[model samples]
Target: MSAYVVVELTVKNAVAKDLYSAAAGPIIREFGGEFIAGGAWSALAGVQGHPQGAIIRFPNRDSALGWYNSAAYQATLANRDARMTCSFRLIGN
Candidate 1:
């Protein structure tokens, strides 16, 4: 089974967000995860949750959870508070 991390976010500081993304990418890869899709979005129906979003795919639920809880990823998130407002959900299939 595969797992995904779906993120809905609105960036407040582009510089900080870029920095965070750069720093987090390698750590995600190290844990067997890769970003499958991301970018601006439009609402076709229902409530528009956020202006931007991304989906990260992992080999399995354990890999997804491992990346999220890893020390390196946690460090990257330390400065994200001033960069964006976001929500992350984990799903498996």
Candidate 2:
């Protein structure tokens, strides 16, 4: 089954976010994942959870989890954590 990583976030440091994104993108691709949608979001109903969000599609759940847990990706966490407040969830399709 395909899998998706859904992220809801608020950026605190744009520079750091950019750097993190640059570094993370390649690793995601290497793990068979690609970003399908991202950027500012609007609330159609109820309360919005966050101002921005992203969705990454992967070949499978294992690929998504592997990308997230891989050493290369894990190394970017310190920067990502400092630059944003976010939530990531894995959804199986």
Each candidate's clash count = 0, 0
Residue pairs whose backbone atoms clash in candidate 1: none
> What is the lDDT for 23 in model 2?
95
| lDDT per residue (tens digit) for residues 1-93 in model 2 | 899999999999889899999999999999999999999988899988879999999999999999999999999999999999999999995
Clashing pairs in 2: none
Off by over 4 Å in 1: none
lDDT of 1 at 75: 86
What overall lDDT goes with each candidate model? 0.91, 0.95
Off by over 4 Å in 2: none
**Candidate 1 on 1-92: residue-level lDDT in tens?**
99999999999998989988998899999999999999987789999898999999999999999999999889878677678999999999
Worst 10 residues of 2 by lDDT: 41-50
Highest TM-score model number: 2
Candidate maximizing lDDT: 2
* Model 1: residue 66 alpha-carbon error in angstroms: 0.4
